[model samples]
Target: MIVSEGQLIQSGDPLLKVDFKNVKDNVPSIVTPIVFTSLIGREVTLEKSGFQRAGSNNMISIKK
Candidate 1:
């Protein structure tokens, strides 16, 4: 994971890094949802600490 548990993450924070150069197109379709689900789960945890989705950039930010 790019960020550790309980780490303060801001908008555009790098969450994960995956190698797609050798990956097939079909693989991304299968993996995308799983990655998003994992991110949403993390967002749930952050929500408890006042984090929220920021606009349509698929980023999370601490609520003002």
Candidate 2:
């Protein structure tokens, strides 16, 4: 990894990279969601935080 004080970076600039083509016979990179989700379960529920209802007025922004 590269760290800079105030340097700017473009789109294709490389920070760090490694080659694993030969080692793929033993292990392979993960490229699927099904295999990944089966390893880890969901962590949260959307309703737990409760819904946001409009204020006094019908508009989303309330009047003072």
Candidate 3:
């Protein structure tokens, strides 16, 4: 979500992305909670403007 079609999102960036389809309006509570756990204690940077590929991430790598 951070890096869209032409934005530059390089490796080693501290970020995470999710792709949700067919959201039934009652699943955010169930699905988002666990997904956010991975981001706990991490820093997030929001772009005021950018375009990135629209889809869910295929893999996530965390460094301890």
Candidate 4:
């Protein structure tokens, strides 16, 4: 799962951001056979990073 409570992540940034098209449209981009995230155990500092939020996103569901 995406870790949104680290040292770098913010409120509106891409916490669990993922696109299915990246798997379907460009299969070659995925070096692995699974849909697991490879960003774990890494340090990311977004203090000076310039990124844009996606315009539209699918409805999200949070299970407690």
Q: Give TM per candidate.
A: 0.41, 0.26, 0.20, 0.21
Model 2 lDDT on a 0 to 1 scale = 0.39
Residue 9, model 4, lDDT: 66
lDDT of 3 by residue, 1-64 (tens): 5555545666556455554454545364423432434577665444333333545353344544
- The residue ranges of model 1 lying beyond 4 angstroms of the native Cα positions read 25-31, 34-64
lDDT of 2 by residue, 1-64 (tens): 5636456775446644445465565567523221222224444323323343423222121122
- What is the TM-score ranking, best to worst? 1, 2, 4, 3
Instruction: Report the error of model 3 at residue 22, Å.
Output: 11
The 10 consecutive residues of candidate 3 with the worst lDDT sum are: 28-37
| Candidate 2's TM-score | 0.26
Q: Write the per-residue lDDT of candidate 1 for residues 1-64, one digit (tens) a residue.
A: 7998778887668888777665665364424432323343333322232333435443433322
Compared with the true structure, model 4 gives a TM-score of 0.21
lDDT ranking, high to low: 1, 3, 4, 2
- Clashing residue pairs in candidate 4 (N, C-alpha, C atoms within 3 angstroms): none
Quote the RMSD, in angstroms, for model 1. Answer: 8.9
State which candidate has the highest TM-score: 1
Candidate 3 runs further than 4 Å off: 14-16, 19-64
Better of 2 and 3 by TM-score: 2
What's the lDDT for residue 48 in model 2?
26
Candidate 1, residue 56: Cα displacement in angstroms equals 6.8
